[model samples]
Target: MLAHIGGRGFPPDEAAERAWATALWERTGGRPSGAPVARQIDAIRASGDRTAELRRITAPTLVVHGDRDLLVHPSGGRATAAAIPGARHVEIAGMGHHLAPGVLDRLVDLTTALARTHGARPATTPTPTPAPAPPTEEPA
Candidate 1:
């Protein structure tokens, strides 16, 4: 998924404020005196703390979290999966707070592995029941 970060989840508060102000200025065709998307920007800033909401995801998922991700935090990724019914979590050994170039490949590989293991089930067949035989003439 394409990320347009503006704080930790988006960018830092200052950067988000600045970026939003700049974008609003640009999009408004230079309306130099305006609210400057302040409310929208504040909402974006508040979205960084979404651990509880993420846990509610019920779809099958594979999470690859960087051990060094200060922004999102490693525990968040772990908590996300644990909250979901059957979600899987994968921690990358050398990943950082954010994905570097080609980081998607690692995620893809992780999800692929999860899908393979999750989709595969042991072969199961019911054992056949033998019919009862007639009683022998043992009594005299």
Candidate 2:
């Protein structure tokens, strides 16, 4: 689960807002009316308790956050990671509000490694093993 943001997850500019808004409005079973959208936003803000909801989740989760995310705000990500029990949080610096534009391969390597491993532990020194002594029996 690669929860990436701060790059391509949001619209690149104001021009795409209409389409984005329309899709979101339609998905919520409401027509794309201005007042309805405003109401939806307000209702979302007034929602109730969710600890039971969060705890009901059964699958593994990944929480990725950008240190300088200006859109969704870093607090939301932090709270989200905290709310989900046992969720892993990863923070990257200088990754703005779009996650798909720059350094894709590097991002892939990072996210993949994150999802797969808990990161490299400091290497432990190998203990030296003593070699066994050979035949002194030939001298007898």
- Model 1: lDDT equals 0.66
How well does each candidate superpose onto the true structure, as a TM-score? 0.45, 0.45
In the range 1-140, model 1's lDDT, one tens digit per residue, is 12332113322345555687699889879867535458767887988867577767876788778765755778878987777767888877656564544465777778677767768554699898998998889878
lDDT of 1 at 6: 19
Badly placed stretches (over 4 Å) of model 2 are: 1-51, 114-140
Q: Residue 115 of model 1: what lDDT?
A: 65
Clashes per candidate (backbone, < 3 Å): 8, 7
